[model samples]
Target: MHQLSLLGTGLIGMFYTQSLHQYQPGVRVAHVYSRRKERAEKFAADWDIPRWSTDLDAAINDPHTDTVLIGLPNHLHKTAILKAAAAGKAILCTKPLAMNAAEALEVLEAVEAAGVFHGYLEDLCYTPKTLKALQAVQNGALGQVLWTRSREAHPGPHSDWFWDPTRSGGGAIIDMGCHCIEIGRNFIGKQVQPLEVVCWADTLVKPIDAEDNAVGLIRYESGALSQFDVSWTYRGGMDLRDEVAGENGTIRLDHWLRTGFELFTETGMGGYVAEKAESETGWLFPVGDEVNALGYVHMFRDMFEAMDAGTAPMETFYDGYVVNAIMDACYRS
Candidate 1:
């Protein structure tokens, strides 16, 4: 069995833990680390983790830890990845890789030098709906792909640090645009190179240094176009939608708005329905097994299997670097 140490106890971290415990029985979260002692202790207890610590190095250096999964803030990704790489532990990091492509290159070099397994957790591309869409496109359901668009928007980020551009790297563009861009690229074919990017960004909702609303268009060498719009000002619940158009046919997907279960409440329902959901009361589209729906379960399971087989998973540090490079161009544009 592969024992893992998890860095960060925030929303994403918790979701990853839950998914691993539920789906990937071959791997276990043996230790968890948080910058705050109290939060770490409570989170470990809540999740029934074997150990908890405030020192990230201690967690990564643990003798039992075969892999280190990082779900920390954008700024801390490079440091944590390097430490885990030095310890010769397999590494799985959340999206965007690093603050920029330069930082991502540092991580790529360290992991390669250490010869450790690595995976990039870009869940949006792994969603069942997305996989189906891509397969259809590949099967010639969409002949000669012309354009693709993806949107991921919510009221805002769950944490305060995301408001600081220095910490979270940009606002909605880097935060959610990464998902849109990657999914679009997947539809356009990974081998295709993005030639140029045109973008427009602004702070439309929250008062933050980074943008709250943004749109970007990527022109590829194959003469295909991929565009995305992200925002932090959308009301109601989270919005995750995508579209792909080709000469023969078109594909449209609504990930969040799809209703497997719906309810109408007079007073208010209990708990949360989805991430960034304003209220659980009234008309609700409550998703069953959000971890499964969001593709976290499949992602971790595949990562563990890939590590065991000594092979790379669907997404890797190199993919993260590419997305970051593209986003950097978008910011510049």
Candidate 2:
């Protein structure tokens, strides 16, 4: 069994640890670290972690730690990843990998230089409905992919670091919008290079330097156009909706529909509503805390297996760099 060390004890860390226990039983969270000693201890107790520490060195260098899962803020990602790489630990890092593309390059350089296995953690790809949508797009069930859109918005992150520009990067776009961008690129099988982008940021409630809302338009290398909107000011719970338009059909996915696809076919009269796609049992856990937790379960298991098989996992550090580069360009607009 591979042993894992987790950095940061925030919500993502909590859910990640829980999912590690629930889904990937063979993997063990042997150590945890946080600036807040009490938070580390709390997660240790809640998840039955064997070791907890406030020192980065201790957690990264622990004898039992074969891999490090970074759940820290955007700015801190570079520090944690470099430290783990230097310590000779394989890495599984959370999304929007760095403060910007340049920083992401630094992380990539460190990973390559250290000769370590690195993967970018993104729940967007692991979600059940997304998996189905990816299949539909790939199978040509949705022919001639024309346009796509995805949105992930929440009522601001609970962490103070997430609110700080220096720490969290740009805010809503970096935090929530990257997921949409990654998904769109993956589903359409296209390289997303923004031709023209326009973004507007707003500070709704948080006192941080980053924008609370952002929107952008992107043109893929495959000639597909996509637009996205993200916000930290939304009053409701986490909301994500995505749609794809094609020559023959359209596919729509929403959080409410769980792990199923809603298909619309082209008919002689007009667009005809077709059958609904069904997902396997336990394909998607309950939304909110449970949804996140389940995603990490798949995330870690795949990381471990890919490492053992000597293959890169679903999202590589390069993928992180691509998404960050696009976002950095959008921020410049």
Candidate 3:
């Protein structure tokens, strides 16, 4: 059994706990932590965790927990990683490991030096359709992947911190571009180094300092190009789509827009329809199982199973660092 010290009482924390408890048997959230005492208590009570604390270190140092799942804000990632590594605990961190490449490198070095198992929680790459497509690409179903495109756009994030440049780093790129960039790496090849990045970002719609809409192109050493576009100005619900073109064939994945299940309610469902849904009254796209649909189920399975087998999971801290580097380049360009 893998006992986890879950950090943060936010949306990501909730999803991670749901996947660990509701789906994965024997995997338990031994402890939960939140900056606010009330949130910590509520999260622990809601998830039935044995212990809860507002002190991050106390939670990480829990003797019963062997792993630390970090779902905290972007600015807090470095502190959590360093503390978790120092405590000699396996760490699983959320996307965009740090605010930028330099910070990401520092945390990555700390984890490597501490010799702890670390996994990058990039859930979109573990989606069922993306997993199958990755397998097919590895099997040479599509010759050499030459070009890939991944787009993830929605109204905006649910948290207030995400809009603050100091807290969340940049805007749309940091929020959603990390997902697209890593998806490209999986489709093309992680071994192929990204050569250059050119991006166009602007604060078009959102009343924020950071860019609200952005598009970027990452050129790889093998001449493959990964294209991505992220926006907070999108009016409709979340739109997630990906495309890969190789020498011989091509593949496409549309996750949210045309998700097999769709519902239209004239009045409203009187409940949450989906993540980042603009409206619950018009056409609602409610996921049957968010934990499964969001790729948390498969992702946790891979992380814990790899721990048992003494092997590295598909996504690691290195991948997260690389994505951060690409993001830094995007901002630079």
Candidate 4:
């Protein structure tokens, strides 16, 4: 089994840990590090991890750790990645690799100098629906992909720090836009690189420095177009949808609304339905296994297997870097 050291005990970190436990028997969380000692200890005990620490170095440098997964804030990603690379640990980092292309380049250089396995955890690309859609596209069901559109919107982030542009980068464009942009690129195929980007962003709901809603368009080298919309002011719940149009056919995926299970509650279920579900007393999507459905389980599983095989996974730091660069350009536009 690959023993992993997890940095951060936030929402994403907790979800990743549970996913590893539930779906990946070949991987185990050996250590956990949180900013707070109490939180680290509690997470370690709750997840049955062997070690916990408030010191980042201790966790990354642990002898029992085979890999390090970073789920920290945007500004802290560079430091964590560099430390993990210096420790010669394989790395799997959450999305939006760095705050900007410059920071992403530093991360790229560090990992390359260390020659450690690295994977970028862009879970949306690995979701079942997305996978199926891409497969069909690859098989020429779409003929020639001419344009693609993807969106990810929610009321806002779970943490207060996300509101601070200094900590979390821009706003909705940098937050949810990262996912939509990557999804658009994935649907368009890797053979074509993004050549140009234009964006419009503004804050409408949240009283933050970052934009609450944003829209961007990307032009690929192959002359295809990718359009994306992201927002933090969206109500009802998390909305994830994508559309791809080609010369021969078209495909659409409504990730949240097209659920297999639904429940109507009068007094609420007294539990969670899905991520960012606004209410439990109304018609609920009631995601069966959110970790699996949202592709965290698959992401970790594929990452561990790729590390074992000494090969790059589907997504890597390079991919994350590209996404950051594109987002940087969009912000400038």
* lDDT top scorer: 3
Across 119-231, the per-residue lDDT of candidate 1 in tens digits comes to 99999888888888999999999899999999998898889988998998889988999999999999999999999999999987687789999999999999999999999
User: Whole-model lDDT for model 2 versus the true structure?
Assistant: 0.79
How many Å off is the CA of 157 in candidate 2?
Answer: 1.2
Residues 191-255 of candidate 4 have per-residue lDDT tens digits of 68899999999989888888999999999998899999998888888899999999999999988
**TM-scores for candidates 1 onward, in order:** 0.98, 0.87, 0.98, 0.98
Candidates' lDDT values, in order? 0.91, 0.79, 0.93, 0.90
Relative to the unseen true structure, what is the Cα RMSD of model 2? 8.6
Off by over 4 Å in 3: none
Q: What local lDDT does model 2 show for residue 99?
A: 92
Total clashing pairs for each candidate: 0, 0, 0, 0
Clash list (residue pairs), candidate 4: none
Candidate 4 TM-score over all chains jointly: 0.98
After the best TM-score superposition of candidate 3, give how far the Cα of residue 304 lies from its true spot, in angstroms: 0.4
How does model 1 score by TM-score? 0.98
lDDT per residue, candidate 3, 8-90, as tens digits?
99999999998888889999999999999999999989989989998889999999899999999999999999999999999
Q: After superposition, how far is residue 125 of candidate 2 from its true place, in Å?
A: 1.8
What is candidate 2's lDDT per residue for 230-328, written digit by digit as tens? 988765345678888988899887764342533333332232121111222222223344444235556666777899999999889999998898898
